[model samples]
Target: MTRIFIQDKATFKTTARTYDDAGFLHVPGRVSKTGTQQYLRRELGLDGDPNARVTVYRPPEEVFAADSLASFDGADVTVMHPGELVNAKNYRKTSVGLIRGPGQQDGDFVKADLVVKDADAIAAIEKRGFVELSAGYTAEYEHSPGTTDDGTEYEYVQRGIRINHAALLPAGAARAGRQARLYDHQPKGSTMSKITLDSGRSVEVQDEATAALVQDHIDRLQKQVTDAQAELDKRQATIDGQAEQITKLQAATADDQITARLKAVTDARARAEKIAPGVTFDSIDPVEIQRQALAKARPSTDWAAKSEAYVQAAFDMAFDQVETTDAHADQKRKLAEDGAKVVTDKAKMPAYDSYTARFTQPQAKE
Candidate 1:
C-alpha cells in the first residue's frame, strides 16, 4: 500500500483560561460543597435562574488532529485563454507572505525543481474564454503530533487533485478560519484512513476527510442558491430600470403644450422592451388584441416593444423562480434520501428523531 506521510505537529488548542480566571486557586474554591448546594437549588428551582451557568465538555481523548484546514484535493489553477497567465507571486515564497496552498512557491507546495502544472493553466485563462483553472490532485501527507508532550512524527505524501483559478483569488490557504461554518462532516474520498497510532493518537483523517466532503457539498448547494438569487436580483433590477423609463416617458408625455406624450410613451415602451422582455401582465384584452392595425396606430410608438418587454421579463422571472424552486425541491429530495439512509443505519438508529424536507407541505387537494 502506498503510504501518505504528513508531519506530526502539535495541536495544543487554545483554552480561554476560564477555570483559572479567578485570582484565588484552591482545591475546592472553584467547585465546593457549598457551591453544589446552591447550584442544586438554582438548577432545581421552580423557575429557572436566568443567570445560572451551564457547561458542556468533551474529554481530551476526543480531541483528534484538528489544527489546520484539511487539504482535500490539492488545488490546481488553470489559465483558460491562450495568453492568460495567473500571477504566481503567492506560489513564490517571496509572494506567499503567510498563506500556503498547493502549487505555492517558496512556501513549498510544488517542488522548486518542477514547474508544476498550475503555471501552465494560468497561461491558458489569460487569453480567451474560461480555461480549466485547476483539477483535483493527490495530497502531500504529513504526520500527526503525539497526543501528549512527547513528540510523534509522520512524513507527507501525494494524493491527486488540483484547483486552478489562482488569479481570481490572490491568496490561498482559505480565508475562512473564523468564517468557517460549523458542521459535522461525513468522511469519504479521503487520502488517509481511520488508522490508530501509538501514544493514544488516532491516525484517522477526520478533520480533513470530513471537512472535504462537507465543504464540497456545502459549496455546491450554496453556489446554487447564490446563483439563483443573483439571477433573480439581476432580473428585478432590469425591471426596475424599465419601470423608471416608463415613469420618465409618462412625465415627458404628460406635457400637452409639447405633444411629447406620444414620443415619451413610444420611447419608454422601447426601453422597457430592451430592459425586461420577460414580464407578462393580463394587459392583453381580447378586444384590444383584435385591433392589430389599430394597435399599430396607437399613439405610443414603443408600446409593443415596452409591453412585450415587460411581459417577457415578468414571465422569465417567474420561470426562473420556478426553476429555483424545483432545484431546492430536488435538494430537499436528496436530503430526504440521506435522511433515510441515516434512519436505516443501525449505528444511528437510536438518534433518528426526525427527518424532514424543505418542501414537505402536502397539497391541499391531496
Candidate 2:
C-alpha cells in the first residue's frame, strides 16, 4: 500500500482545459464538494474505498437550472490564473457548470469562464497535461489510534475542511505539494517519527539508528573532554608541588650559607686572638670578621696562609701603639718604613741606633 501523506495545504493535478478562440472554456473547477471517496476514507472522516480515483468536473443539474444565466459575481468569486487574479475585464463568468464524468452529484462542481488576452499564455497551458487549484479553508483534525497489519502502532486521521475560495493556478506552478511535505503536521512515507521544536517547527526522523549513532559520538566526545580536563588538573597539581619543593630547597640553601658564614667568622676571630696575644678582638663584631675573611679569601689561593698574614699585620699595627722603649720605638719605625715600600722608594728597615737616630739630624755646633 502506497501511503501518501499531506500537510495543511495539498495540491493535485486536475483535468486540463482546451483553449477556445473565444478566450473562454467551460472546465470543471471541482467535481465533488465533499471530495472523493478515496480522500474521504483515507484522509477525511467518511467511509469509502481507499483505492478509488477522483477527478474534477461539474454536475448537470446545476448547469441546466433555472437561475443558471445569472451575472458572474466577480465580487464573491475571484478568477485567478496561477494564484493571481485575472483582470476585471478578462473575467466573463464564474459559476457551476455541467461536467460529463462518472459519479458526479448534483451541484457538486465549480466552473469559470476566463478570457485569454495573451495567446501564448493559453498555448502554454495546453502543452501541460494538468492544471492546479488552491483553496483556503479551516479543518477539524481527528486522530484514530490503530495498529497496522504488521502490528506497528499507528494513528489514522482526517481533516474536515470548509473551503472559502478556490483559485485556479497555471500548469506546473503550484508549490502546495512541496510546502505540505516540508511543513506538514503528519509524517508520511518512510518517516517514523518527528521532533517538534519549541519554535513550532517539526523535523522528520527517517533513520533512528543514525540518530543513535550521532548521540553516541557526542557522548564519547564529552567523555574525552572530561578526561582532558582531569589530565590538565593533574599536571597543574604536579607543577604546584614542584614549585613548593623548589621554594623549600631555596630556603634551606640560604640557611646553610648563613651557618657557614657564621662558622667562618668564629674561626677568623680565634685566629686573630692567637696572632695578637694582648689585643682584645671580643669587641669586634663576628659579621665584620666574616666580611674581612671573605674579602681576602681568593679562589685557587691558600686561605689559611692569607688569613695568617692578615692577622699578623693587624697585630703589628696594634702592638706598635703600646711600645714605649727606644728598641721598641726603633722596631716600630722600621716596620712603618717597610710598610711604605709600595708607595715610596724607601729603605726596607730604617737605620737607627736609637729612636732619636731615626729623626732628622741637628745642625753642627760650629
Candidate 3:
C-alpha cells in the first residue's frame, strides 16, 4: 500500500445562505461523494511510476469510514487549495473558514456543515458564485484493477481515506486542476501573491488581504526584535568604554607608584652620601645605609638589635651634630686669619677693653 494525496470535487446548488448571530455564514453541503472515479497522478517517490495517470476508485466503505469522515470535522476550509498540505505550520495563513461538523453518510455522499468566517471568502462565494468544494485528503492506494458495479473501470482503489482540508474551488475549477498537487510544483506567482516590506523583503501568500494581515504581524514582531538587539548593542558599547577607562586609570596609578618609589630611593642615597661624604652608597638598601651612618657617628655602639625607626633617628641626630661642629670650626678659622689688630683711639680702645674684660679675671698687680 502506498500513501497518495488526493483531491476530489463536488458542486452544491444552494441559494439558502444563512448566518448565525455572530455574523458567520453557514453552508450545508456534501464535501465528498462515494462511488466516484477520480483521475489521479502519482507524485514522485510513491510506489507506482512517477507522474503516471490512473483512475482511482472511492468506495463508500472507505469514503464513509467512521474515522475518515470524522477527519473532516474542524478541518480548515481554504478559499482554494494553497497547493500544499494544510497543517499547523501554514494553517493560520491559508485557512479562511472551518468545516464544523463531523461528516456523516447522507445516502451516497458525506454531508457536513462549513462556516465562512473571512469576509473576503464570503464575498467571493456569495457574489462570484464560487460554491464548489474540493476535498484534499490522503489515502492508501491498493493496486486492484477491477470494474465497478456501474461498469466504471479503475486501476487503483483508495483505502484508509483521511480528510485534511476542504478547499472552496473557484467557479469552473475541476478536480484534475494543477492546484491539486503541492505548491512547490506550481508555477511562480500563479496561485499566490507576494507582499513586499519596507526592507525590501517579500513574502508569498495565497491571497492579498490575508497576506497583508500576515505581513503586518511579521513587521511588528520584526521591529520588536530589531529594537531589542539595538538596545543591547548600545549598552555593550557603554560597558566597553567604561572598562577601557578603568584600564587606563590603573596603568597610570602603577606609573605614579614607580615614580614615587624611584624619587624616595634617590633621596635616600643623597642623605646617605651626606652622612659619610666619600662613601659609595649606590644600589645599597636604605636600612643598611642608615646603619652605616649610625656606626660612623658612634664607633663603639652595636646597632644590630635596633629597629629601622630607631636607627634612622640616631643617624639623623649624628648628622645634625656633625653639621653644627663643622660650622663652629669654620668660624674659628676665620677669626684666626684676622688676628691682633690693636685700637689706638681712646673711645674705641675703652669699648674694646670693656668687651675683653668680660672674658678675663682680675690679675694681681705685679
Candidate 4:
C-alpha cells in the first residue's frame, strides 16, 4: 500500500458544518502542494487514463454491505495522543458519507459528513480541539526528471496512481502534516525534508526541525550498535583467558608426570644397588624395567616354563658358590658329594644310555 499525505491548514475546522441537512466534519481531502502533487501523480493517479478514476472509500471493517458499489455504515474513528498513533485509544464509530467535491481533480477537496450516531463522540472530538485524516492506497508510477526552485535536479512521478481507501483520523497531526512538510513545493526556511527516489538518489528537502529529528534517530541507532560490539569483545576476551588457563594447566600436568617418572627411576636404582653389592646397574632405565616386568608377567608359550626353571637352577648354583667361604667348608664339601652321587645315579638310569661322562678328575693346586 502507498501512503499519501494531504494537509489542509485552511480546513482544520472542528465545528460541525451543515451540508444537505447532515452534520459534516469537512476536511481538505487534497492540496496542491509539491508533496500532494507527487502523491497524486505517484500514489493516486490524477495523470492516468481518462476513463479510470480514483475513489476515496471507507475501510473493509466499516463496510456493512457490499454492492457493485460498496456501502459503508460509518468510518473508523479514534482519538490519538499528539505526535504518535501508538497511544491512540478511546474509540467510537460514527457513520460518515464521503463527498467528492466538484472538478474531481488533483487539487480538489473531498469532504466527510459525520452521521452523528454518538453524541459522546462529537463531544470528545470538540474536546480534543485538533484532528487529521489518513488515506491508504495502492498504485504504480514512473519517475521523471524535475528541478526545484533553486534548479536542483530531482525525480517526480510521471503517471498512473490509484487510491484504495481514506479514513478520517483524529490526532494524526504528527504523521500527516509533518510528512506533508517534507514534500512541500516551497518549504519555509525552517522546514526539513528528505526524499529518496527509485534511482538510488537521495535529496534532503528538510527544515531545521526535521533535520534534528533525523539526526536524533541516527544517533540512537549508532549507540545501540556500539554497545553490542563492546559486549561481543568482552565475551571474546573471557574465552581467550579461559583458553590460556587450560594451556598452562596442561603444561603443569606434563611436568608433574616427568618428575614422577624420574623419581621412580632413582628409587629403583637405589634398591638394586642395596640388593646387589659391588654390582653397578648403570644401564637400568625405570621405564625399560617396568616394560620387561610386564612382558615377563604376560602369558607365553609352553617353552617359557622350562626356560624359567633352567634360569632358576643356574641362579641357585651361582648363589651357593658365591656364598660359600672357609666358615662353611664342611657344608660345601657335603653338598658337593651329594650332587656327585645324584649325577652318577642319574647316568645309570634308562634315559642315560646315550650320555657319556667327559669330566676329568680334580687336580690338586699346591
For this target, which candidate reaches the highest lDDT against the unseen true structure?
A: 3
Best by TM-score: 3
Residue 50, candidate 4: how far off, in angstroms? 34
CA deviation > 4 Å runs, candidate 1: 1-207, 255-366
lDDT of 1 by residue, 1-366 (tens): 232221110111111111123321111000000000011212222246655632211112211112112221232222221122224653432111111232222110121011123333223223332211111122222222222221212122122222222221221222221111111123333244343333345545545434334443454456557868999999999999999999988775675724654554444444334333432323333222322222333345443555654544543454466568769999999999998987578445433332232245554663
Span of 10 residues, lowest total lDDT, candidate 3 = 177-186
* Prediction 2 global C-alpha lDDT: 0.40
Query: Per-residue CA lDDT of candidate 2, range 49-102, in tens?
Result: 865532211123432233332212221222342232233444444321122322
CA displacement after TM-score superposition, residue 163 of candidate 3 (Å): 0.9
- Residue 350, model 2: lDDT of 50
**What is candidate 4's TM-score against the reference?**
0.26
- Of candidate 1, the 10-residue stretch with the lowest lDDT total is 28-37
User: What lDDT score goes with residue 25 in model 1?
Assistant: 12
